[model samples]
Target: AWCCGAGGGVKSAFPDLALWTAGQRVDEALSTGATVLSSACPFCKRNLSDGAGNRNVRVTDIVELVAQAMSGRRMGLT
Candidate 1:
């Protein structure tokens, strides 16, 4: 339940800080051994995906998850 760190103009005004914050949140998610991190916000998905660069985590939107589920596609680490 942590922020993806793309809020309050922090991403545009301070890219590095935003990335760092997003990375922290990603790390927290990784700690739980989660392979996918779903967000309701597009900005969060972008920031979190950027933060997850080179990692085994997949950052995606809830809508996409639903679409995949509805389509009967398996969602996993790729």
Candidate 2:
């Protein structure tokens, strides 16, 4: 897992910057040939999800994915 750009006390004052940071991280993920990205923090998940909108990738909290798995729902963790 990696940063989602929602930390470092900047998200509250500079949401745009946080999104920009998340975009960078998401770009890195795209290069890895992965389609799914997961993080444990809610803030990270939110920022990452926002930055990754409609980018052929899925961002989610790992705990949610585990719950989905236990419920037999179709999901991924790439």
Candidate 3:
């Protein structure tokens, strides 16, 4: 989640709220013309990806992108 409003014990304690919060972030990301959502935190990635659902968005970790970049592979929605 780019804006950082999801994850931590919130998702563990209140899952519905976590996904709902993640949805808000995904909406903002969509507005910015972002095709891929990236986060280093597993919780954020999981929650945000769940929020993305059928939308044309992909959730990834920054490390993955860096690795792709190092390998000279373009990283983005395919």
Candidate 4:
């Protein structure tokens, strides 16, 4: 699970703060090598998705992902 960063307006008010926070979260997630990074909020989704960079990780809303997963339609599956 990714921590909340944009709650304090870190991404919009301070980019470096946002990058640092997102990078830290991404590193933690990457350490697990999880294919999907799920979150509840839209800002967290944006931050995590952007922080994922070139990795195979994909960010998504938990509910949306769950619906897709239940339907057997994975998000970002092309």
Scored by lDDT, the top model is 1
User: What is the per-residue lDDT of model 1 for residues 1-78, given as tens digits with 9 covering 90 to 100?
Assistant: 777789988899999999999999999999989899999998999999999999999999999899999999989986
For model 4, give the RMSD to the true fold.
2.1
| Model 2, runs deviating above 4 Å | 71-78
What TM-score, over all chains together, does every model reach? 0.93, 0.81, 0.86, 0.80
68 Cα displacement, candidate 2 (Å): 3.4
As for model 3, its CA RMSD to the true structure in angstroms is 1.8
The pairs that clash in candidate 1 are: none
Tens-digit lDDT track of model 4 for 1-78: 446466677888987777678768877877886678789889998887777788777778989888998999857734
lDDT of 2 by residue, 27-72 (tens): 9999999788888888888899888977989998899789988999
Q: In candidate 3, which residue ranges exceed 4 Å CA deviation?
A: 1-5
* Cα lDDT tens digits for candidate 3, 7-52: 4588878878888888888889999998988888877888888888
Ten-residue stretch with the least lDDT total in model 2:
1-10
Please report, in order, the local distance difference test score of every candidate based on alpha carbons: 0.92, 0.85, 0.81, 0.78
| lDDT of candidate model 1 versus the reference | 0.92
